[model samples]
Target: MSQYWELLASRSDDQHTSEELEMTAYRLAVEQVLYYADRHSRTAYWMIERYEREFRQALVPLGIDVQVNRQLRYAYALPKHAKAGTASIAQTVFALVLRAIYDEAASIGQLTEGGEVLCDLVELAEKYRLMSGKELPTKGKLDSLMETMKRWGIAKKSEDHGLDDGEDMAGQPYAVVIRPAIADVLGEAALARLVQFKAVASANDEPEAVTSVAEEGESQE
Candidate 1:
């Protein structure tokens, strides 16, 4: 067996330190994504820059299609055939919210300058309430969803590392570093559809239907 297999077999055990794993480019590429999971992160980008070919050679045979956008300075993965699972309603709503926020921020050069926009959970809830006339997810549920977003590389907790769960976080703002990757994932066509969806949903009071539309749109991608 190759050293890769040896490392894989021993990965679950305490046989290798992070430093050891990062020594090999292939190992670094896999470990960077599997553990840290922000492909645009400094370390991950560095690994991709230095070892992208090795990364592709390693992942392709395993049914993981990897994409490296050199100009954009990011890399990502998709399963073979690129079929994606539909997100839950809450997740879809959260993604839309992020997309809206990112677009607004990008227009004014906030995100373009690498400055992150702060997304207050309380304000987000208020926005959702105003849009849907329905209460947003409870504090705990929203927090859980935020965590999932963090893992998915959509956002990151701010510098202050605000409270994890709070119903009254309106005053205390938590920062989220939104990535440009959202635009890539959502795409321009889907965004146009979402714009229409928002207008119609807002007018017709059918915000719940947004999830189904989003699912259909994603499936076509």
Candidate 2:
């Protein structure tokens, strides 16, 4: 995580405005910290402390430690409401799907590519274990989720594909272009983690497929 923060901070040096850097730092802190907490099942406070420490390490060298406390406070506050309130598991599942797609794109440098698009929703759902087969959401549900993603600026619709085409059309896929707003907020390392997760998930998926093939071969024998 420290390495990622360093990469983002370095990227920020020439291109980003001071305010943007500050915002990036805060966003990275919140997301990465929460991710660590979620993975380790640690309390949010522990995550906050780790985030602050990493942030300070990342910022102090840049000669911009003045707003560190303010940013830390904001970062720490993000998980408070999330932790106390009940969140829909469906929403969580959908977000994980989005994250996986974002990661896959990033790994291939598609996130930085101008025309790179999102993978189809059905394919994305399958990759993330959200759907067991080619089953897609109803039109209403699909539209609702697409609209939500658009509002968040994590995704947008291309005129290329339509809902009527079913599974075959799923191959045409939605292109996921990274929003500058989110890229600006999250920095490179956090974005890179998405890529990392995609690789791990891909590796995990391959083994299951291999095992399934072996079983099929055994049955044939």
Candidate 3:
């Protein structure tokens, strides 16, 4: 890996450095996901594409698996054998619902040009009610959970106007854009887990199925 880094450094342009490359790798280790289309992740995404081989070798010892989806133009790090999602019940439920929305839109080709599904809060609320038989957490609680979703590269806020003075917000927009990475991060099996959680939560079983997908590794944001 040291020799590979040296070679990359030698062939690199003055605009980027070996140190930058190393830091970018660390950023991937920490951030877990990077999208080529995301403005904030463009540099890191390019570095990963440029030194794909080195990154795969470097991350292996850390028990990380690199998944580069050229179709979606995103890179994600999956821990080899651990819990892949660390969202609490509220957050996990939101993620699961959002993933469902994304899948539904994708089936109908309703996704944005960038392959993301733009969803309204009302849709989220409706889906949440259907999935868990509970009311969606309102105001700051919902907003905070969205932030966590964005941090984990699953979803992001767009055209958000915050909560209103009252709770009669039927058509208001607390819209979220579901990222393509969500598909890779949470597959069909995640929805299955969501079903599992619903049973657990309904049974007053102490919310046992907190982890979204993985089995052993830490998958939280």
Candidate 4:
């Protein structure tokens, strides 16, 4: 197994507090899922389940519903249906790219500030080590992808002039706006997966538990 895999497995046997353990495990799971999915072309649901079963129980208690299979289908199928006339391969690639970006942004708990630019894409691709077997996209292809995203309202671009310079910059950084509708697209499954992963990871590290933290602090006093 890879070092990462070993780390994840060993984490299951750690004696850290529950919260600390859970956080470590959650990060590992997310990184692993992204790595595995990108390499195997597996759907998000599969990644979710793989990590969920190992790390946490379920997020239902947090008022998040998780519908596993439905989320998988929607995550994979919607883009195809959304752009019927376009090249299926391109559409699919774009959808996966967007999903990866959105997932990373969500994990970080904040959207990027660059207008219309999904900054996470490059980071995710590098983390997953995804390289197009084909040559890099031509300018036209990139433009088409941007246009499709804009049309779908998944992203938008705007230019703001710098008052200090009193100059209108050409092609200023684009800000990519993520639609709230994306949450509906993945449904409750995503939340459930996150919750389950958290729980399982926490279980592995007893010291890291929330209760343990409180107890330890009290004992120190």
TM-scores, one per candidate: 0.59, 0.36, 0.82, 0.33
Root-mean-square deviation of each candidate, in angstroms? 7.2, 15.7, 4.8, 21.4
lDDT of each: 0.52, 0.39, 0.72, 0.36
Instruction: Give the winner by lDDT: 3 or 4.
Output: 3
Candidate 3 structure quality by residue, lDDT tens digits, 185-217: 776766765676566555222333467433212
Q: What is candidate 4's local distance difference test score?
A: 0.36
Clashes of 3: 6
Evaluate residue 32 in candidate 1 and report its C-alpha lDDT on the 0 to 100 scale: 21
Model 3 residue pairs with clashes: 81-217, 82-216, 82-217, 83-216, 83-217, 84-219
**Model 3: residues >4 Å from true position, as ranges?**
1-4, 13-15, 83-85, 159-173, 202-209, 212-221
lDDT of 2 by residue, 1-221 (tens): 54554555465454534444455565544332222212222333333344556456564553422122222222321111112122232332344455446656666876432323446555554664532222344567666656655544344455322224445455654533333233222233333333443444421122121111111112222
Q: Give me the runs in candidate 1 sitting further than 4 Å from their true place.
A: 1-42, 68-74, 84-86, 112-115, 126-135, 159-170, 192-221
Candidate 2 TM-score versus the reference: 0.36
lDDT, candidate 3, equals 0.72
- Which regions of candidate 4 deviate over 4 angstroms? 1-87, 112-136, 158-175, 186-221
Error of 1 at 204 (Å): 17
Better of 2 and 3 by lDDT: 3
